[model samples]
Target: MSVLRLVLGDQLSDDLSALKDLNPDVDTVLMAEVRDEATYVRHHQQKLALVFAAMRNHAERLKGRGVNVRYVRIDDADNSGSITGELARALDDGAHEAVVMTECGEWRLAEHLAAFAEGAGLPVEIREDRRFISSHDRFRRWASGKSQLRMEFFYREMRRETGILMDGDQPEGGRWNYDAENRKKLAKGVTPPDRLLIPPNAVAREAMGDVERLFGDHFGSLDGFGWATTAEEAEASLKHFLKDVLPSFGDWQDAMAEGQPWMWHGLISTSINLGLLDPLDVCKRAEAVYRAGKAPLNAVEGFIRQILGWREFVRGIYWLKAPEYRARNFLDADRKLPWFYWSGETDMACVADVVKTTRDNAYAHHIQRLMVTGNLALLLGVHPDQVDDWYMCVYADAYEWVEMPNTRGMALFADGGIVGSKPYAASGAYIDRMSDYCGACRYDVKSKSGDAACPFNRLYWGFLERNRGRLRDNVRLAMPYRTLEKFGEAKRKALAAEAEACRTLLGAAPME
Candidate 1:
C-alpha cells in the first residue's frame, strides 16, 4: 500500500522536511488546482493565475525528481475542485496514511483538513514547516506572561535565536532597530533603481490568457503581470533586489511615489509565501550584504525585521486567535466597501493611483496598504468583512493567516488594539506628507469639513468621534480623543454632517 501525502499550491519546495523519509515508490504527492480554492472569495484573476501556474510548475519539478505526483488540473474531467473531495479520491487509490506539512494559512482550511482526515479512517501527520525560522510554539513561549506583544521585542528574540546581524553577544552597530533613520521622504531629482521585473514565460503567458478568459468579471487588471511563476525566476528576482535596490531599501521603504508601485520593495512576498524562497535565507543574505558594506545596516535590519518580526508575529497571532479572529468587529462598522477598490475610479489621486497599481499588478508596498487604502477604509468605517475580502481578493501574497491580521487588525483596526495599539486611521494630510499624488488632487488635504475637503480628512474626524467610547481608554489615542473633546457640540455635529455627505457621495466608489 502507498501513502498519499497532500501538498498545497503554496507548499512547493523540494526541501520540504516532510518529504525527507518518504519512500518514493510507496509515497504519492497530491497537488491540485481546485476551483473552490480559486473562487473562494472571488480572487483577482492574476492571483488565480499565479497560484495555479506556480502549482503546475512545482508538480512538474517534483515529477522530474522521480516523485509520484497525482497532479489534478482545474480542467480535468474528474476534478472535484475541493481539498476533501480530492483527498478522498486519492485515498481510495490504496493509501494507508497521509503526511503533510502544516498549512501556511487559514483556520478554515486547517479545520477542514483535520475533519476530512478523521473521516477517511487513515492516520494523518502534519509535520512542522521548517521554512520559517520561528515556530508557533516558540512565539507562544515568548509571548507568555506578556500583557502586550510588541514586534520589536519579538524581533530581538528572533535575532538572538537566528544569530542574524549579531556581533557576538551584541547586535551589529550596537542597536536593535534603526527605523527612525529609515523614514526619509523620497529625495527630489533622484531616479529610483530599476526594479527587477520578470517577463512571464510560456507557462505564465498561457495561464494569463486562461485567467483573462475564465475570470473576466473579476476585479483588478492583468496589464502589469510580470511576477515570476517558477522557483528559478523567483530566485533571480531575489538576487536582483539584494544587489540593486537593497542598499536604499530602508530609507525609502515607507516612501510612495506617483507612478511607482514597487519602490525599494523586493516584490518577493508572493514568491516567499509560495515557498519559492526561504525567509531565513533571504534574511541571512541581506545580513551578509550589510557585512560586506554593499547594503546599509538600516536597510538590512529593516528588511530582516519585516521577515523575522512582523511576518512571524502575524502568523503566531493568526494561529492563536483564528476561527474567532476573523469575526472581530470592535468598531461595529457595517458600511459596504466602496466600489473604487475594484474599479480604481476615484477623485482622490492617491487613492486612484494606489488602486490602479493594485489593479494592474497585485502589488502595493506596506505604506500604500497601511496609509492609503487601509487608512481610508478605517476612517470611513468600512466593514471588516468588506475590507478583508478586498485585501484577500486583490493581493497575490494574501493567505488568510497573514492577510486577516494585516487587514482586520493592523490595517482596519477592526480588532481594536490587539494587533495595533491605536487605530491607523488618518486624514489626507498623511498622504500629502508621504506621496506626491496629493498635490494633483482636487480635494483639500488640510480640510476637516465642507464638500471640497478630502474625504479622508472629513471621515477621519467623524471616525474618531464615532469611536470615542471604544478607543478613549487607549493611552495612544488620548491625544486625538482630547482634540475631539475641545470641539464644541455644534462644531462636532458639523464635521459629522460633512463626513456623512462625503460618504453619501462616494457610496461604493471606494471599493471599486
Candidate 2:
C-alpha cells in the first residue's frame, strides 16, 4: 500500500499525524512551491522568500529523517504551476491513497485540495490540524446558540479549559485580562529590548532574488529581510524572545516608536504561522516564565492571550463563518486604496513610519498593523478588498484566514460586528498616545481641519459622517456620532476634501 502525504508550505511539522502510520518503505512525502499560491495575492518579496526557504528546509529535514521526500521548487524544469497539478503528476507514478493534514489557514486553499482529492477518486484522509488549542468542533460548540460572540467570554472559557493562569480553578490576580496595565508606553530613557535576527543563507538569498524579480511590480520592498528559515533557527528565535524580550513585551506590545520598528515585538509570527513553532508550546513556554518568576504576571498573561485567546478565537470565527465570511462587507465602503499605501509617502508620521518599515522589512507589530496602517485604510474608506489584499500581501504573518478577519472585521469593520463589535476607527489621538511617530510628524495630531492638521484626525471624523447611516445603530459609535453632529455639514465637507487631497498625493513619485 503506497501513500502520498502532501505538506503545504505552512504545514512543516515533523511529527504530523499523517506520517505516524506511514510505512517509510512505501510512503512518499510531497512539498512544492506552486505559482498559484504565490501569485494569488501578490505577496511581499520577503514573504515568498521566507516560505519557500522554510519549505525547502523542511523538505530537507524530512529527507534527512529517512522519509521519501519529493520537493518541487518554483523554478523546477518540470514544475506545475499549481498544487493540484503537482499532485496529479506525483499520483501518476501509482499511489494508492493520499494522507493530508488539514490546512493551517485559508479556506480557499482547503477547498481546492478537497476538490482535487475528490476528482482523484482516492480515499483522501483529511486529518485534523491539532496544532491549535481550539478545535473546529470546540468552536462550533462554543458558538452554538450564541446571540452575540465576544472574545472576552470565549477567552474565559479557554482559561478554564487550559488551566492557564488559574489558581485552583480561579483566574490569577482575580482578573482575566490585564489589558489596562498592559497599555503603558515605554518610560522616557527606557531602552527597548533587542530582537532576534536570522540572517538568510545562500538558499534564502537566492529565493529572495527570485521573489524580487518575480514580484517587482508588487507592494512592499525586499530590503532588510531577516527571518528564520529552518526549524532550528525558528526555535532559537523563540528561546531568545522568552529570555530577553518577553518580560517587557506586555507594556510595549501595543506601543509604537518613531524610527523603531521592532519595539519588543515577537517576530515569531512568520515562524509560528509557517509551522516551525507551535502556538500551544509557545503558551506553555510563556507560562513557564511566570512559574520561574522571570516574567511578570501581566506580561505573561498578555502574551498568552494573544496566542491562546485571540489567535485561537479568530481561527474559530474564520471556520464558523467561512465562504460567506469572505464576502462580508458591513460598511459597504468603495474607495480605492490610496497609492500611498504602497509608496508610504503619506504626511502622517505614524503611517509613514509603519509603512516604511513594512516596505523595508516586510514586518510590523499588531498595534502598528491595526492602529496604524489598518486604521488609516479603514478610516479613509479604502475598499475592503484593497485593504484586505494589501494586508495579506505586506505582512509576513498574514494568510487569508487570519488577515481577512483582522482586517475586515477588526480594522475595517467590514463584517459589521462579527470579529469586532465596532470599528477600531480612531482619530490621530490614539496614535499620539501609543506612538512617538506623531511627535516629529509634519501633520499636527491635535488639529482636526487645517492644512498642517493630521489627515487621520480629519479623516476620522469624515469616516464617521460617511458611515453614520450604516454604523449609527452601534452603541459603541455614539460618541463619534455626537462629535459628527457637532461638526455639521460645512466643516465635514471641508475635512473630507482635505483628506481626499492628502490621499491624492500618494504614489506620485516614481518607483525605484
Instruction: Give the TM-scores of the predictions, in the order they appear.
Output: 0.97, 0.95
- Give the per-residue lDDT of model 1 (tens digit) for 1-512: 46677888888877886676767888888888888888888888778889888988888888888999999988789999898899888877565565554554677777888887677776777777877777878978988888888778888999998999999879899999999988878889866888878887888887888788878788777777888899999999999999999999999988899998888998999998999998999999999999999999999999999998899889888887777888999998878898887888789899899898888898888999999999988877789999999999999898998899999999987877668888888888778887788789889887767878888988987888788789889898889888888997887787777777888877833333
| Runs off by more than 4 Å, candidate 1 | 95-101, 508-512
lDDT comparing candidate 2 with the true structure: 0.83
Error of 2 at 369 (Å): 0.8
Candidate 2 per-residue lDDT over residues 216-325, each given as its tens digit = 77767767888999988999999999999999988877888887888887788898888899988898899999999999989999999988888888888988998798
Using TM-score as the measure, which candidate wins? Answer: 1
lDDT of 1: 0.85
RMSD of each: 1.9, 2.7
| TM-score (C-alpha, index-matched) for candidate 1 | 0.97
Clash number for each model: 15, 1
